[model samples]
Structures are given as structure tokens and as C-alpha cells.
Target: MSVSPEAIRSALLARREIALIDVRQEALFALGHPLFAAQIPLQRIALEAPWRIPRQNTPIVVYDDGEGLAEPALHQLRALGYTQADVLEGGLAGWKAAGYELFEDVNSYSKAFGELVEHRRHTPSLPAPDVLALIEEKADIAILDARRFDEYATMSIPGGRSVPGAELVLRAPVAAPDPDTTIIVNCAGRTRSIIGTQSLINAGLPNRIFALRNGTIGWTLAGQALETGRQESVEKGEGSGHDLARERARDVAYRAGVRRIDSADLKGLIADSDRTLYRFDVRQPADFAAGHPAGFRNAPGGQLVQETDHFAPVRGARIVLVDDLGSRADMTASWLAQLGWEVLVLADAFDGPLETGDDGAPPPRGPHGRYKRPYEGTDNREAAMQAYLDWEYGLVAQLERDGTHGFFVI
Candidate 1:
């Protein structure tokens, strides 16, 4: 028997755990789906299910938009040892017929959550022209790109250095040692820039800070040129101000209700057959490859926040984050907690031995179902970019109507 759309919505509103997965190409899933639906393409479920939905008995509801993919997907899941798998009754059509809301774009919830954060916190931002003027005058300022290294390398602000989201609190001191220097954080578009800037202010950084409004898209619209082939990045080791940043991050985590746990506590969480748990190391990919505790996968803290659905498909799951440096995990856990996750940070430093390798994430597949993000890349139609921003502005109201996201800003 299949699960009904109303049942899934009821579970979500009640904060119960369920994996309402969309087993279609990402593009199709992105076009429209319920707010909490996670896309796990039918072609990749076998490769991804083991880790992405780790627990065998997780309440799994797979659906497809009249594509006849759900049944096969359910079969593969059961063959792989999943016991509570079922199809979403009537598939995507059933969801629509039930008069429920469908969200667009990939990582929809995180994007919506980011909008909620800015809406509630009034995250500060400066228009591109003003920032450009500051830079042209050689003002005492630092531009840190809060994106992946590869994305930063593709194109960046002329003087910007890569200091991805999770790394901001950990490395801001080294990036801009002078307390008086102004700090600007930016991404391809608004979300990361807003989150990164707010993160520093929340962490009690003394430097004056602002997000470059609308990010690179805003800069491009204003006819300002972005520099390409930039390789500057934050230094890898613990910076001089690590202690201060760590303390501030811990405080933020505490305020957001994130718990600090040790190995013994973690063992109990793992043994709890009643709940699903996701373990990740919220450090840079390179740092994770160097060594990490067993069973923890690498998820750079910033991206983890941006792509929570992709990393942890099951809603209402318990998440445990690890970082040798306390601040990175604490900062990430703070955001996770606000996103309504039962998140905790591991305080113990591993002593005995650790596993070393890549994060074991699935290899990238063809762009068959990939959604084209207008904010990405240097060349995008101006109308599409503006429309993307417009879509984001309306998310807060839609979230209110959806009434399933239990997020709270701290």
C-alpha cells in the first residue's frame, strides 16, 4: 500500500521522521514538488540509498510525476534491505490533486530558510556600486567569497579571497587581521552572502561587516566586471584568533539549543533503533581527507547548510557534526539547530585511529535532470537572473502557507 499526501504532510507538521523522496530527474523534481520532498533520481537510488538514507527501516515514500518510476524505485529499495518503503499514493498528481503546495528550484527548503533568516534578522547588505567604490579607493576592506573553491576560481570579485561559509568564523581573523578593516562576504547570489555576513556578526567579530547585495549577479547588473582565475584563499591552519572565535561560536550554538556530545553519548544515539542519525565532519574537504573519525562523512559546514536535503533526505533526523576545531562544528550545528534539526556537536578529539579517503559521495552523473541556476556562471540572461531574485523575495510568504518548515532564526 502507498502513503497518502495528507499523511506525509501530517507527519511533517508533527515533527515526525519520514523520507518523502522524489525519484525523478532533478530538473523535473525542481520544477515543482512539495517543500520537504528530496530528489533522489531513480537512476541513482541504488548508488545513493545506502548512505543518504542510511537506516534500513526509515519511513520512505518515493514518488514520481506520472513517470511510473515510483514502483521500481520501491522495489530496489526493498531489495537493498529497506523495510518500511512505500510509494506516494497517486504520485505527484495525487499531491497536486490534494491541493498542496509545490516548491521550485533545487535545495528549495534551504533557499527558503535563508530567505526566512534575512526576513527575521534583517541581515545587512550593501549595493554593488557602493562596494565597488570602496574597493576602487583602496579602502581598508576584505572581500571573502563564501562559495566552493572551484566556484571561486571560476570568477570572483577583483580583490576577493575564498573563505567558504563554514570557514568564515574560523579564518576571518587571519583574512582580515586589522579589526578596523571592513569585511564583505558574497556568493554567486544572495543566500550565502547574507548567511556568511550574519554568521560573523553573530560570532561577535569586531570588524564592520556587510554582504554584497545580490552578490555577483548584482555586480554584473551594475556593469561592474568580475575578475576570473583568482586563486587567493584563506590559510589552512588555526588562525591567531581561534580561541576568541571558538568561544563566540560555542555561545551561538548554545543559544540555538545545539548539544555538545562525547563519544559515549554518540554510541547511545547510534544504538537507538528508534531514530535515524546522520554523522558528518563539517570541515574543509581537504581536512576531511587528511583524517576523520570512522563513520563520519565530509560535508563542508557551509554547503551542508545550503544543501541539507541532499545530505540528509530524511526530515526530522538526528544529526551529529564533528570538527577537530570546535568552532567549525559549533557554527554549523547552530545553523542546523535553527533549521529545526536535532543537531549536536562532538566535543571529543579523536585519539586512537581515523579513516582516510574521499567523502564517498556518488560521482557526478550527466546533467539530465539538473536545474539551470541563473545565478551560476558569468553568462545568464538578465531577465532570468532578476526573476530568480524575485522568486526568492516571495518565499517567506509561501513558507507561511506551506506550514511545514519548523525553522527559527537565532
Candidate 2:
């Protein structure tokens, strides 16, 4: 049976329990999707539905761009024990025809919530020019790229170390042991930067922590130089090879008792949730945009670990992560378990299965969008820069006030 857009809207309005999934590529989903519509592409429906919906009996509605994708997608869902699966009567086109609102943009709700966080929390940040000057002067400031190693390798602020998302929680303190040295976080854009910087401040690190006002994207547009080379890991073990990195990360995960789930286990998880379940494709944004499981949110693993509080918010919520390679998720879930989260790495859920460390192929770099930070533009925007800083400063206290973080920093 097909479900009408109004029916979906009414259910959401009433806060009724249902799982609404948009089976489109991340790029298309980013363009527009219904509020609360978690995206998982059609090709990945069978693997993701159970893990994300976590309630086989919950109403599962899948929609596509009025193309013929939904029917086959629904069939896949039913085959996976999503017995309540149905398609939107006319797909995305029908939702629009019903005059219902559609949300657009990446992390749309999270971005709005981030803005709200800025308003309520009064976070603080360093203006891009000031940060750039620090780099030029050979100052004591440490610039850490809070993106994947590959993304960092593609391009990064000169002298920046690839700390990644989860590693920040483990290594930030070690990066700047002195309270006086500045700690800066950057990604291609704002979300990860904000989340990464705040994670440290929230963890009660005594250092002066700040997110690059925008990120490398902002830096690039300002005509600043980005050095492209191998992603240099600051904290090295016996050796810097992939095997050593994987072993070190696995040790951490095992110490935290992070569990790995197979396809059938995931199917049962989909049968268990009474509340909303979020499955995140914790890979780089561009990788997520290419394709991912249906119902998966595009939260790069590192950022997901760094900003667990802001992203998930729901205490005791079950989260499943999908990665094109196992190491990133494994590394992330380890820290998440220590932070007191119930996280699982869904091995088979990912389409075009992730490379094991054994694959020996280097990680791929993604297209870095050109986004200029407000402070760097011609306006100078002193008020905006200061306001940005003020917002970040407050997150430390917010994390304290809401103490049931349910995060385990592995």
C-alpha cells in the first residue's frame, strides 16, 4: 500500500512513531527532503532499513524522485523483514504536490541547531585572519585538521596535523599540554570545525581551544595557501603504516568493548526500537554524497565522535555507523563506547564494501567546497567573529549542564 504525504505529515506532527526514509543519493537528499527524513539510497535498502529503523513493525515509508526506484526499494525492505514498508504515494513529487514543506541543504536541521547553539551557548572562535597570522609568525598555536586523513592530505592549512574526528578526543590534550598554547580545529566547512573544537572544551580541557572561524574552505577562498602532501599523523606508534594504525585503534576499541554487528544482528535491531534510531554513514561528506545506505545520516566518523552530544542529543539512543572502510568506523566506535554510547559498526550495510586496512590502497580525498568564513570576507565582520567566539565559549558549560552525555571516549 502507498502512503500519502499528508498522512506522513500528520504522523510527524503528532509525534507518532514511524520511520520515514528518503532513498536518494546524499547529494539529492541534501538538495531537499522532508524534515526527519533520514536518507538511505535504494541500492542499500536491504542492508540499512533494519539497522536504522530498528523496528520492523514501525511504519517504514520510502520515497524517490518520482522515478521507478521506490517499488523495488519497498520490495527489498519487505524481504529484509520490514513488513510495514510502503512507498510515498507519488514519491518526492507527491510530497510537494501535497503542499508540505521540504527541507534542503546538508545537515539542515543540525546546522539550524548549531546556529541555535551559537545563540544559546555563546561559543567563541578565532577569526580566520588572526589564525592565518599565527601560522605565519611561527607562533606556538597548533592547527589540527579535524577531518579525515585523506581530506587533510588533499589540502590543509600549512603545518596542520591530521588529528581526524575521534582522535581529537584522545589526542587533543596531548597536542597542547600547556593551557596557554592555542588549539585550533578545521574541516572543509563549519559543522565539523564547530563540533570538533567544542568536543575538547566540553571534555574540560584547560587549553585555549578555538575552531577555525570557517575552516580550510574559508582559508582557501581568502587566497591562503593549503599545502598538499601526505596526511601526517602527529601521534605515531611503533610505525606509521596502516597496519600499525589499525592495531592501535583496535586495541582501544577492544578495551572499550565496542561490539561489531553482522547483517542478521542489524535486522533484529530494526525490529527493536520504539523511538527514533539514527544510522550515520560516518565517512567524508563527498563519499556520503556519492552513495550510502538508505536512512543513514552523513556524519563523518570523526565529527560524529567529537560532537556526539550535539548530533545525537537523545540519551540512550542506539546508533549504527556505516563506512566504506572499516577502520574509520572502528576507530570512531571505540571512542564512542568510552564516551558511554551504544554504538555498533554495521559491516555489511555499506554498499561497495569498505576497504580493510589490508586493501593497501590509500584513502581517497574528496572535493572540498569553497566556503569563505564571514570574518575573512571584505566586510571584516568583527561583530560576527566575536559572536562566533562567544557561542563556542558556552558549549563547555552546556555539556556540563546536560550531564547525561552517554558518550564513552575510547
TM-score of each: 0.97, 0.61
Which residue segments of model 2 deviate by more than 4 Å? 6-17, 44-55, 97-99, 236-317, 320-410
The top-ranked prediction according to TM-score is 1
Q: lDDT tens digits, residues 173-240, model 2?
A: 56676778989988765656765676565445677888887676567556676678756766622223
Q: Pairing residues by index, what is the TM-score of model 1?
A: 0.97
Off by over 4 Å in 1: 236-240
Cα displacement (angstroms), candidate 2, residue 122, comes to 2.7
**What's the number of clashes in each of the models?**
1, 30
Q: Give a tens-digit lDDT track for model 1, residues 11-104.
A: 9989899999999988788789999999888888899898799999999999998888999999999999999999999999999999888898
Output the lDDT of residue 263, model 1.
Answer: 90
